[model samples]
Target: MASRQTRLRVISLYKELHRLGRDYPDPSYNFHGKLRGLFEKNKDLKDEAEIEKAIKLGEYIRNETLALYSLRKYRHLKRMYPAVSPTDPFP
Candidate 1:
């Protein structure tokens, strides 16, 4: 059986990812469903090394999701305000 700490951390990570999936960029993709499915697929892992590896992968995914959100915001901002040129006078 995995240690209590490990179990708690896994649950917390799952919750975090689930929350992030709420605003996932692609409306066609079911992020929350996919997240749950993946977690279910790995729930039987008994080896610590394997579990750790999976957690690391999950964290990497979380980071990538945040990056995607940031890029989306950047695109929106860029669209709203075109870059000013040197020749343009400040308003």
Candidate 2:
């Protein structure tokens, strides 16, 4: 099970990503690479508290990058899952 802070950070990241994804729609390696890097760096954090903090920051960065990258896609996404919307961009 994940820590409370980690879970909270994860949720925050999702929101941030969804918002960003909604503003900019694009499918580029650079965009994905940066998002992936954020996750990877967060995973590298050793201390639990530090990891949680990094996770939160990672989520923010990832969401912003994704949102910027997929703004158009995000707009169309609202039509699919109006409630959840871009929260699950893959869907």
Candidate 3:
């Protein structure tokens, strides 16, 4: 079980991620486009092995970008507010 501080931090992170998802016009604008462009430009990633590698790489990029954004927003909130009692469940 998380302590009150940890739980509050997690709840705050969720809220920020929700906000970012709504405010972000282009979800793929960050890593998806960049990685797709990278793969499209690469001539060597045409075969099955290379294609799989590209797909994995793209997935990694997307996950990493999302995780970074989540952490960034969490930090932003941590700096902005103190821990609350979490009156309601994380939305």
Best by TM-score: 1
Q: Write down the worst ten-residue block by lDDT for model 2.
A: 21-30
| Residue 54 alpha-carbon offset, candidate 2, angstroms | 1.4
Full-model lDDT, candidate 2: 0.62
Better-scoring candidate (TM-score), 1 or 2: 1
Off by over 4 Å in 1: none
Give the TM-score of each candidate.
0.93, 0.39, 0.47
| Model 2 residue-pair collision total | 11
1-91 in candidate 2: lDDT tens per residue? 5677766766667556645544444455454456556666665556777866776666567755655557757777877864754778766
* Candidate number that wins on lDDT, 1 or 3: 1
Local distance difference test values of all predictions, in order: 0.93, 0.62, 0.55
lDDT of 2 at 65: 66
- Candidate 2 residue-wise lDDT at 19: 54
Candidate 3 lDDT by residue in tens digits, 1-91: 3346644543454454445445454666663444445745753443655555654664564566578778878898898986766685663
lDDT of 1 by residue, 1-91 (tens): 7889999999999999998999998878999888999999999999999999999999999999999999999999999998888888893
Compute the lDDT for candidate 3: 0.55
